[model samples]
Target: MELDCTAVIADVWLMLDGECDESTRARLQHHMDTCSPCIEAYGIEEKIKGLLSRKCGGDRAPDSLRDRLTLEIRKSVTVTRIETTEA
Candidate 1:
């Protein structure tokens, strides 16, 4: 099966996060091996993820920021629940 750019892009993150199935990961890697643009994007994303992982390792989010994100998530969940019920 031929892979399109959209499909490759969609699964790139899952592949990076080690969450994708072997078949899908192989397909993505095959595309990256052949496609220059996808390879470049993949490299950039990998670098960014690595940088964030290293940076976040010994750091913690301040209480204020954590509280704000918590509130936002809760609000988002509530809104989604209400929309689901309406639907």
Candidate 2:
């Protein structure tokens, strides 16, 4: 099953969170290996996740905090989608 850039981008977060099955993860990895744009994109996301995790530390974020973060991420993704479409 070949994956396109959009498909890989859509699932990259799930793979990073270890929510993807082994097969799906393998497919994503292969795409990342072959696609320089995806590699860059995934690398940026991974770094952001890592930084957030480290800063947030061991304790779970409060529900309000999580919700707000989710909203922010959604907004950012929306903006990115618009920019990509324009480009």
Candidate 3:
């Protein structure tokens, strides 16, 4: 059977996140083993994920920033509720 590259691409994130089942992982690994394009794509994705993990790992979000975001979200939700009630 021909491998469905589109389906594989769609599930790449799940595969990378280690959320896929054993069967799925095996299928993806098989595909990657035989397909150079897929292997290169996977390598790029792995690098990107690694870079993002490093960049966002520590002290990325200050507590004050989080608190302010929470306050803003609450204020927006309150305003939205009032607007919906009036409408």
Candidate 4:
């Protein structure tokens, strides 16, 4: 499939994260290789991903906290909206 700048911008995250498959990767890579704007975006995203990996990849939440969060997530939630009064 032919890709434009918008397509590359949209998929930069997938490419940077290595989430897309090889064929899609190749297509995005090819476009990035040839297109200046796509390449610039790709470079910026690459750096951001790299920085995030170095900063946050090693941190993990405590198991107790994780369990509490999991338990809370399993419970149902209810939302109620209150009407606002205006003078």
lDDT of 3 by residue, 1-87 (tens): 556555555456567868789998999989888888778877887887688778888545676985685566556656765787799
Writing each residue's lDDT as its tens digit, candidate 1 over 34-76 gives 9997788788879987898898895766979856865665566
Output the number of the lDDT-best candidate: 2
Q: lDDT per residue, candidate 2, 1-87, as tens digits?
A: 888777777677778878889999999999899999999989999998899889979667687985676567656766787799999
Winner on TM-score (3 vs 4):
4
lDDT (CA) per prediction: 0.75, 0.82, 0.71, 0.69
Ranking by TM-score: 2, 1, 4, 3
* Clashes by residue pair, model 1: none
Per-prediction TM-score: 0.62, 0.67, 0.60, 0.61
lDDT per residue (tens digit) for residues 49-81 in model 4: 788778997676697985675455333111111
- Show model 3 residue runs off by greater than 4 Å: 58-87
Which candidate gets the maximum TM-score versus the true structure? Answer: 2
After superposing candidate 4, which stretches have Cα over 4 Å from the reference? 59-87
Candidate closer to the true structure by TM-score (higher is better), 1 or 2: 2
TM-score of 3: 0.60
Candidate 1 ranges with C-alpha deviation above 4 Å: 58-87
Q: Is candidate 1 or candidate 4 better by lDDT?
A: 1
List the candidate numbers ranked by lDDT, top first.
Answer: 2, 1, 3, 4
RMSD of 1: 9.4
